[model samples]
Target: MSTDPTRETPHDLEAVDRDDAYAQLVARYSAPERVAVALDKVKAEARRRAKARQLVTRARGGLLHNHTVREIARYFRKAERGRVDLLQVSEGTGIPLTDSRQVLREFVDAGLLYEYAEPVGKEVRRSYALAEGGKGGITEVFIETEAASRLEEQENRARGTLGWGEA
Candidate 1:
């Protein structure tokens, strides 16, 4: 039997005090055993969320990083002058397969590199090289800043001073 009107609904008992309930909860969780369990649960949840975030980030990624292309270019510069497989380049550069494929295609189209296949006893293995006739103008493109060089090359190509006009 409670005196508080809120507690004495129709023909009911006392209402629970929020502060008392909270204090009880705090005391229960403050115990070492409870604290350890709670901490472990929190840490586990954090790890799960972190893994989810990484997956979401990779899945949602739209634009390819220029640095990734630069890294792949550097890989090509150091690679042997023979063709290498897509998997080999991806593994060596630690770039994702999809990204490596796209970048390599772009590089080939841009003539920063060339792509071909060589017979591997029974099969042909696709490969790439940095030498576009002699060597790719990686430094020229990336060093001059991608945007500015693109603009410059556009003007130069139009004026018959570079790219297809050069040859």
Candidate 2:
């Protein structure tokens, strides 16, 4: 029974101490039988890296640093409304898809990247390009348009209907 007199309740009998319950959970998952879960994660990451390397090899490009924002900017140097899918960026840059997406997002926020939706068939596909002024002078209209495009792309992504194209 709980020590509090006013809190009389039948469910109180089933309540376990928080610390004790946490320790039990830790012990349960730490058992040898559960160690495969950890190993499986490592193996999965290895497979992803191997696939990324294969893609880099197929693209005939050197692997860039994992998280270089400058490299991404440089990739868009000659782009004026250049159309590129997210998977192409991932393969060309040799960065993981999630990381490349994040860096692109940061570039978008910094006005170095211009994101827009290109109509592909019946659905709109997202793409990015370098701002016209070379990141020195981004117009207010460009910023607003890019911001709206990014928001709409995010919504499409969440809905899982927007295809990023061959990865």
Candidate 3:
């Protein structure tokens, strides 16, 4: 035999073919149920997180609305003896007159604000002020309490969903 090693080898090609076949067989028989279950769990967790975020946003909105209403009521209670019109309240609170009117209307409906209507064409303008019970009005307390309750409920739900205390 000639002493030469620069020749094509059949065993090298056969080994590569065997490796490919083994990989294909492993892929074809793999079980995917575990991956599917994990994916489902991830999706469910995402949905729960989204709902918790929505609750937080709603709670914050209620808190802000209650705080603003309280501020407006406090402003009126501290004003001079004379009545303050909606425009004056709006100017003092740095809120638009239209928004102030809306808040006034809500407070009036809720019995937290009292409205005084002057005679038509009278030089004196109509005005609004805190109701008879002043800052301790039932409506004001109700709004504040409701906001607080909602915030607490949201926090509890978030904590429970995130498994904060669960073993």
Candidate 4:
């Protein structure tokens, strides 16, 4: 109980960092099982943060994320007409024209949208319509977090195939 202002006694509250205090308390008093559970919680939080960061990185790299795809679907569902063109989608969704076109083409390639050239007077206009249960298809669409390591992986090639029903 010495009253030295500049001295950091062992009992002083500010002498040790918060993390060191927690470590010392847990090590000395916590049971083994409780310590293991605490560690597991810490690891799960780290993984969750890492995954969120990875998703942000992927979106920044020009890859559309799950929420963006859902937003496009919502626009199509709420639009006056089922059939639309790239420009219409860009304006309706408020996404850039280039990004809208790219995402639509990706869906077309994935068989979610039916694309055709419509004759608008003398000039042809490209149009797209949602396939059967296109909203359902959009819901099923998943963004790849990582690229497949092997070129010969058939699963990677079959991107949007329907899930195999349970045996």
Give Cα-based local distance difference scores for all models. 0.60, 0.54, 0.58, 0.59
Question: In terms of TM-score, how similar is model 2 to the real structure?
Answer: 0.35
What tens-digit string does per-residue lDDT give for candidate 3 at 3-112? Answer: 34454355566555767899887777664666778788666545544433333343357633544454465565565435678778888887777667766665565555
* Top model number, lDDT: 1
lDDT per residue, candidate 2, 1-167, as tens digits? 77875665556753446546888988987875577887875665455444333432322332432224434544554345466877777777676777677767655655455688779899877677764443332232233334444665688889876734413
Report the C-alpha lDDT of model 1 over 17-82, residue by residue, as the tens digit.
655688899888789788799898666545544432332233235344555665575676654557
Of 2 and 4, which scores higher on TM-score? Answer: 4
> Sorted on lDDT, highest at the top, how do the candidates line up?
1, 4, 3, 2
Output the lDDT of residue 35, model 1: 79
Instruction: Tell me each candidate's TM-score.
Output: 0.40, 0.35, 0.40, 0.41
Q: Count the backbone clashes (under 3 Å) in each candidate.
A: 1, 0, 0, 0
Model 3 superposed RMSD (Cα): 22.6
Native-referenced Cα lDDT, model 4? 0.59
- Higher-TM-score candidate among 1 and 2? 1
RMSD of every prediction: 16.6, 19.0, 22.6, 17.1
Q: lDDT, candidate 1, residue 84?
A: 76
